[model samples]
Target: MNIDQLNTDYGIPGNLTFATGKGGFPMIHIDNGKAKALISVYSGQVLSFQPATETTDLMFLSEKAYYAEGKAIKGGIPICWPWFGPDPEGLNRPSHGFVRNRLWNVLETATTADGATKVILGLKDTEETRGIWPQTFELAIAITVSTTLTVELITRNLGNKSFPLTQAFHTYFQVGDINRVEVLGLENTQYLDKVDGGVEKTQLGAVAIANEVDRIYLNVTNELVINDPALNRRIRIKSSGSKSTVVWNPWVTICANMADLDDTDYQRFLCVETTNAATDIVEVPPDGEFRLEVIYSIE
Candidate 1:
């Protein structure tokens, strides 16, 4: 469904309201009594989320972020589906699949009993998706905004055969200072270093940033807390149906080369993605479904 149809069907008081956002794409601005959020219909991406108690938004959006069709926005929660990171095959397609760069149909919207707003958006496989990755599938993202922000992506296979899949809720978190941030929960875990040709290494202590970091922690089931000393607050991240957790920051060198990111933008944001990558690849059976979800809250 297009933006007009969505506005006509499920528009409610203190729920998703249709409006044009960056790059003239239709977006849903939500204010459901407790929290506020912005979701882009183009990618079903939650671009901003802030609870009532916090003065700052939990998610970050790049100033130079591209908002045009088929271009991935720099920040927020970008869905990396069917495959994550570089082309799984030798096909040299987009880095994080094509789903995030396409329009998603708004399927449902409602206010729950607790006055939280819930919105569901979906996308199905067509000939265009098949040309890149051959599969019949249906993908939907369900977001609930209240005291905490919840985002869940559900994938269902529509084909008769099984298919391999890897995905991530590529979430960028806003922080006061990247240098003063410490990520807790992945300590004593082994990670695959993406910057060093996927070499394996074990984490020694709480993750502290001093330089470029790109690692995927394997088999993690713990809740992560971003301890921001500068902000004097902690952001809690809890997830389910994910085995790998990715922590990344471009630092100085790579940040300078990215067209969509400002050189100093890396200082204000860090990515701690809930993912299924490397050895945690998922095999979806015929007519089967899989889910990846995460919750962000302030403490």
Candidate 2:
């Protein structure tokens, strides 16, 4: 476990800690002594970040955490790279590709010019990975935490070859009430409704999830607000390098079928994903780079 400890004063309460596993993979965990994130300093797996202050959490937690062995933390923001879900072409491959489930390395860490601490987590293709997609690549994922949390994915081809992939942060947010919460900013946008089994439609008024919802909106801008009236707080989502937004809530019957997901957990969480799907497929030329960034702040 190669853990990169964040810069801190001798006894400061909460500070950041970054790590790389046996092969120098990247993962960061924060512990202010108040909210201890149960993590492995080596593997980039956020096994658990639940604070004791809250009894029930809305974080993404794997069914049974096996941090030392590098099982991708099931829930949370599993960075789906090269692909999302099952490939429509069909294969014996894993879901969302192998990035989340595999271990990554800590490439570098430094304070940013804006006074924010930036830690870059990196993962390169091994001979084993080449079997799946024979492309030499470098995926650098940087996380900066200040008043808000910013997760950035910057990919480059180091093998003198082109790389094409689909990706997302798969962010799961904790909410006070699914009913009282309404997602604003998608008023005039158009979305491909998945609940109707992949039909396209334009959204009307503010997006509300009174029932099951799954729609992937195409050509998005930089803002989304989760108006949690019950909690009297707003969860703001801002993004760059993305042209899509996927709002999903596995409501009603779907919630009960997910063994890893708590049945009634729907009441406390919502997945308003920031993505570049649909007509927004990202392609990187040989030796070229592409970046997609997403930032979330809760108030």
Candidate 3:
């Protein structure tokens, strides 16, 4: 709980802000500004966010990709690949599957013997990803934001051979309304809709999230509930190695074409994603090493 090192000036100019976020871990390393807005401050609870700015900005505006950190909703932490949506098999070779536009390197961060405040983001297996799927891998992304905000996705398989893949952490949450919300523990179970596009629905009980709700819940064993009755609290969305769970709400024409979103920002926000991707891929094998962990509690 000692994460300080900021100096606002997203005004941009020669940018090279290193990165450091530990105040309690919601994220904020604006990297000398330039759209480095990972600003959640953990919870002062504002509304409109997305200030990452540039560095190739792959469209997720808060200001638009600042240092372009790994990826997060429109905030920070986005590492979905091989397939999370679209191209289920249409020349699937790129786009949203190489670790969010690729560019993560910040290996170790400290203080955690019960003090909690770690931050290790990494990715490897280059040479153009073993030429579109061969093997050799090492992708680690660990984040521990004190009170609440723990995102981890570690997969290592330095190729001896085996290395199957399919992942997701495309989580985009920022709610206050989204129709008052209701995602409590997926009652029935079974989802996979992608939009009206994939279609494979199920869960028909305690999980009300109105309109454009994309599904992808299969064999998932509980750990979700965004019942944000307008921030009264209740955002516990836990997950382990992963079984399957990807609920979304882009309603209202994708929030009016998203320009930083906020035509009511889909009422506020909801993109409960915690997946293993497509048919739940993760074959590690070779040197073996596969993991996925996400926690954002605020009950």
Misplaced by over 4 Å in model 2 are 2-14, 18-27, 31-71, 112-115
Tell me the whole-model lDDT of each prediction, alpha carbons only. Answer: 0.91, 0.68, 0.60
Q: Which TM-score value belongs to model 2? A: 0.82
- Candidate 2 residue 201 Cα shift, in angstroms, is 0.6
Q: TM-score ranking from best to worst?
A: 1, 2, 3
lDDT of 3 by residue, 1-299 (tens): 22333323221223323334332233433332222224333321111222233122211233332333333335444667545665555776655565565445555654456644455666677787778665677777776645556677788887677756778877667677778778878877877777777878777777677788778888788888777766566667888988888777778987778665666667655777889866777777888888888876665
Question: Compared with the true structure, what per-residue lDDT tens digits does model 1 show for residues 188-253?
Answer: 999999989999999998999889999999999789999998888899999998999999999998
The better-scoring model by TM-score among 2 and 3 is 2
Best by lDDT: 1
**Regions more than 4 Å wrong, model 1:** 1-4
Task: Give residue 140's error in model 1 in angstroms.
Answer: 0.5
**Model 3 spans with C-alpha error above 4 angstroms:** 1-28, 31-34, 39-120, 123-137, 140-156, 161-166, 180-199, 202-208, 211-214, 217-245, 248-267, 272-299
How many collisions per candidate?
A: 0, 11, 26
